[model samples]
Target chain A: EPEVTQTPSHQVTQMGQEVILRCVPISNHLYFYWYRQILGQKVEFLVSFYNNEISEKSEIFDDQFSVERPDGSNFTLKIRSTKLEDSAMYFCASSERDYGYEQYFGPGTRLTVT
Target chain B: AQTVTQSQPEMSVQEAETVTLSCTYDTSESNYYLFWYKQPPSRQMILVIRQEAYKQQNATENRFSVNFQKAAKSFSLKISDSQLGDTAMYFCAFVASNTGNQFYFGTGTSLTVIP
Candidate 1:
C-alpha cells in the first residue's frame, strides 16, 4: 500500500538555526497535515494544508512555522528559528478526502535542537 | 475544541492474552471520527483501527476491534491474542467531520506484551 514518507529521519540543529522537514504524501491525497509530539507528550496539531494553502493552524504554529507544497509530491514544514522546545517527533499525514476519512501517517522525523 | 483522554498511562498483557485500552473524549460535534494509532519503537505512527461516529456497529480490523460509545463519548480498543509486536504506545485520536482535518490525540497508553 502507498504510504506517506518523510526525509531526514533524524535532524539535529543548533538553537536559533532554521530547519526544514520534508514529506512526500500519498500521491492521490488532497489534504495534508503536520503534527508534533514532544517526548512523553501527546501529539499536537500544527497545521493543515489543502489546495496549497493553509486551512487551519494551532497556537503552536506561530510565525516561526511555515508549510509549503513546493512540488506536487513534496510537503515541507520550515521552522524559521529552532528552539529547544521545538525538538520533537514531527509527523506528516494525508487523506484522500476532507471529511471523516482516516489520515495516513508517515514514520515521522525526529527533530533535536540543542 | 476536542480533547482525547487516555487515563491509563501504562498497561501490560501476557502473550496470547487479550487487552483493552480505554479512551474517552470531549467533543460537542455529533459527527466526527475516532481512531487508534500505534507508535512502535521506530516511532512510526500506524493506524490500527477507526470508528465513524455515525456507525452504530463497532469497527473491527482482524484482532483489533473497538468499543465505540457515541452517546457516552467513549472509544476503547481491544487487542485479542496479543503478541510481542503489539507492544507500543497507543494513542486515541479525534477529528471533527465538518472542519479542517487536524487530529486531536491523547497522551497515549504504553502497552507492553510480556511473554
Candidate 2:
C-alpha cells in the first residue's frame, strides 16, 4: 500500500534557527495534514491543506509555522524560528477521497529544537 | 469542538487473552467517524479500526473490533487473542464529516500485552 514519506527522520536545530520538515504525501491524495506530539502527550493538530490552501488550523499553529505544497507530491512544514517547546514528533498524513477518513501516516520526523 | 476521552491510562492483558480499551467522546455532529490508532515504539500512529456514526452494526477488523454507541457517544476497542505485538499506546480519535477531517484525539491508553 502507498504511504506518506517524510525526510530527515530526526532533526536537531538550535533555538531561533529556521527549519523545514519535508513530506511526500501519497500520490492522488487531495487532502494533507500535519500533527505534532510532545513526548508522552496526545497528538495535536497543526494544520490541514487542500487545493494549495489551508482549510483549518489550531491555535498552536501560530506565526512561526507555515505549510507549502511546493510540488505535486511534496508538502512541507517550515518553522521560521524554532523554540525549545517546539521539539516533538511531527507527523504527515493523507487520505484519499474514496478511503473516507482513513489517513495514511508517515513514520514521523522527530524535531528537536535545543 | 469535540473531545475524546480515554479514561484508562494503562491496561494490561496476558498473551492470547482478550482485552478491551475504553473510549468515550463528546461531539454534536450527527455524522462523523471514530477511530482507534495504535502507536508502537516507532512513534508512528497506525489505524487499527474505524467506525462510522451512521452504522448501527459495530466495525471489526481482524482481532480488533469496536463497540460504537452513537446515542451514548461511546466508542471502545476490543482486542481478541492479544499478542506481544499489540503492545502500544492506543488513541481514540473523532472527526466530523464536514470539519475537514481534523481529528480530536484522546490522551491515549498504553496497552501492554504480557507474555
Candidate 3:
C-alpha cells in the first residue's frame, strides 16, 4: 500500500536555527497534517495543509511555525527558530478524504533542538 | 473542541487471551470519526481500525474490533486472541466532520502481551 514518507528520520539543530521537516504524502491523498509527541506525552496536532494552504492549526502552532507544499509532492514544516522544548518526534500523516478515512502516518522524524 | 480520553495508562494480557482498551471522548459535533492506532517499539503509527460515528455496525479487522457506542461517546478496541506482536502503545483518535479534519488523540495505552 502507498504510504507517507518523511526525510531525515532524525534531526539535530541549534536552538536559534531554522529547521524544515520534509514529508511526501501518498500521491492521491487530499489532506496532510503535522503532529508532535514529547517523549512521554500525547501526540499534539501542529497544523493541517490542503489545496496548497493551511487548513487548521493548534495554539502550539505559533507564528514561528509555517507549512508549505512547495511542490505538488513535497510538504514542508519550517520552524523559524527552534527551542529546546521543540525537541520531539514529529509525524506526518495523510488521508484520501477529509473525514471517515484513516490517515496514513509516516515513520516520523525525531527532532532534537539543543 | 474535541477531547479523547484513554483512562487506562497500562495493561497486560496473556497470549491468546482477549483484551479490551477503553476510550471515551467529549465532542459537541455530531458528525465525526474515531480511530485506533497502534505504535510498536518502532514508534510508527499503524491504523488498527476505524469507526464512523454514523455507522451503528462495529468495525473489525482480523483480530482487532471496535465497540462504538455513539450515544455514550465511547469507543473501545477489543483484541481477540492477542499475540506477542500485539504488544504496543494504542491511541484513540477523533476528528469532527466540518471542523477542518484535525485529529485529536488520547494520551495512549501501553499494552504488554505476556507469553
| Winning model by lDDT | 1
Which residue pairs show collisions in model 2?
none
| Stretches of model 1 off by over 4 angstroms after superposition | none
Per-prediction TM-score: 0.95, 0.94, 0.95
Model 1, C-alpha of B95: deviation from truth (Å): 0.7
Model 2 docking category: medium
TM-score of chain B of 1: 0.97
Indicate the residue-level lDDT of B80 in model 2.
99
lDDT of each: 0.93, 0.91, 0.92
Supply the global lDDT for candidate 2: 0.91
Top candidate (DockQ): 1
Pull out the clashing pairs in model 3: none
lDDT of 3 by residue, B14-87 (tens): 99999999999998988898999999987578999988888899999999999999989999999999999999
Ranking by DockQ: 1, 3, 2
- Tens digits of lDDT, candidate 2, A1-114: 777999899999999999999999989899899999999888899998888998889999999999999978899999999999999999999878632478878989999999
Q: In candidate 1, which residue pairs get closer than 3 Å at backbone N, Cα or C atoms, i.e. clash?
A: none
Task: List the lowest-lDDT window of 10 residues for candidate 1 chain B.
Answer: B94-103
Isolated chain B TM-score per model: 0.97, 0.96, 0.97
In candidate 2 chain B, what residue range of length 10 has the lowest lDDT sum? B95-104
- Tens digit of per-residue lDDT, candidate 1, span B30-71: 889999999898867889998988999999999999999888
